[model samples]
Target: MSFKTILAVVTDQAHMSDTLAQAVTMADALDAHLSVVCIGVDRTQTGYYYAGMNAAVLQETMNHAREQAAELATAAKKQMEMSGLRWGVSEAVCQLADMSRYVAAHARFADLAILPRPYGDDRGIELEAATEGALFEGQSPVIVLPEGGAELKMPQKIAVGWNESAEALRAVRSALPFLIAAQSVHIVVIDPPKHGPNRSDPGGQLSQYLARHGVKVEIDVLSKTMPRVSDVMRRHVSDMNADLVVMGAYGHSRFREAILGGATRNMLETSEVPVFMAH
Candidate 1:
């Protein structure tokens, strides 16, 4: 399936400008509608009526949030128009419920959601909450762009973390559009020495599979002695100058392992490139 609409979740964060630009560019390329959503807290809802904050203070805070939302919406709309994309900007403020859940619910119909990496103070926690809800709860493919990652070209080289699991296969299928556009595609698999499959080599099997699709593909295997699977993947991503990384989200329960699995967790923490992930 191809993406027909791109949803960008924007907030008062460090990479707002860059993220907005990237979202516009992608929307233009895909000829998709760009929806820039800004989420905030609203003090006017009924649930907060009991809190005894002075009337003036509550009014001031609510007014300030509304003003900020308007400013952000205007800036985002200007950028989208400047990019020559057919776009629509939206804003949502919820006082009675969590903003993250609201964003996730809206994200359900979107083809993809682009989010900024969490950074600094309470911002990190907020970003994480939103990202988790959108990724796990929304059931939509999400792209988490690194800070200051506005300049995104069609990726020349794409790397897929392959383990032949169900999640890996799903990730690969979800990324086929990008793969078809990529100049080079590499499948990196880390094999366990002691207890894993023992064949002459399964890497060639995957390469042959891709070759059938008229894609120039290669496979690389790292030794079991490598420091960590994620570390090895990051090293290769740097060496290969890969612009995009595709991987499966290997997590069972939200609270049990919010950022579960080895490769998913490590790349989320250290990779300098954009990651395309799906559960």
Candidate 2:
């Protein structure tokens, strides 16, 4: 019912600071152990690698990455030790293709996984692969942070992106702890699925369900004028000053390559706040 062991991915230099801030806060709040996984690897072994960089250049590039990883690991270790919370780090130097599997193998046992949003950019395919692998290859829910940054709080305001799919149901279940603790919970229905909220039967009894669990629930039906409703959801969350967005990740994947749904894809690309996702 509580997050007791939180696993955070700490690659992606752009996302490093944000990861530590949120991970440490979550760990401190829950009296949990924060395990940091910094995936540093030689992509040359896998035939394809970082865009435009050859093996010789990549070796130098990864040397810089490794140095930064070491600095981060040292800082995390010291901070956790001072905070009186248990922590560990894994700087797994391995093949690029195996990175996702490496992360999932370790992440499956944790209560929650924290990750950076996977970008299909020239240099970020591995991060996306790891995130995708975690979503489908593990049971735990993942909280993905946008590149800008985020801090974990007591989650005073929370928004649930509503849909009727099994993934949505799983996401609601996954977010129980946060919902049970929030000051206000919004069931945001945008372009609902077939069995979702409607004019007369708004929220399809989910509001009642959450209310039964002592959650302060409200249902809102938002009309979407854009193709990507995820953008709308993020806007709503920001408008509500919600700290967390709970939703299902709807997507198709092959060879660790994911073709996400519009809402899911947009959220990954442009979330201003932390997002809890399950699939």
Minimal lDDT window, size 10, model 2: 251-260
Which residue segments of model 2 deviate by more than 4 Å?
12-14, 45-72, 120-123, 193-199, 251-261
How much is the lDDT of residue 275 in candidate 2? Answer: 87
Q: How do the residues 1-279 of candidate 1 rate in per-residue lDDT, one tens digit apiece?
A: 678888888766455688887787777777788788875556464556546777897788777777767777777777777777777888765542466687788678888887776533435455766676676678777777875553665677998888767777777777777777789999887773445573556556667767777667888776655677888888888889899898887544545445444667667767788888888
lDDT of 2 at 163: 69
* Candidate 1: regions farther than 4 A off: 42-62, 95-97, 119-122, 193-200, 203-209, 224-226, 250-252, 256-262
Counting clashing residue pairs in each candidate, in order, gives 0, 0
- Candidate 2 local lDDT, 1-279, one digit each (tens): 888899987665566766777788888887888888877654555555667777689678678667756766766566556656688877756466777788888779898888877764524667776776677776778988766655676577899998666878789888888899899999998875555245467686888888898999998888886666777888888888888889988644442324435677778777878889898
Candidate 1 is scored at a TM of: 0.84
Reference-based TM-score, model 2: 0.84
Among these predictions, the greatest lDDT belongs to 2
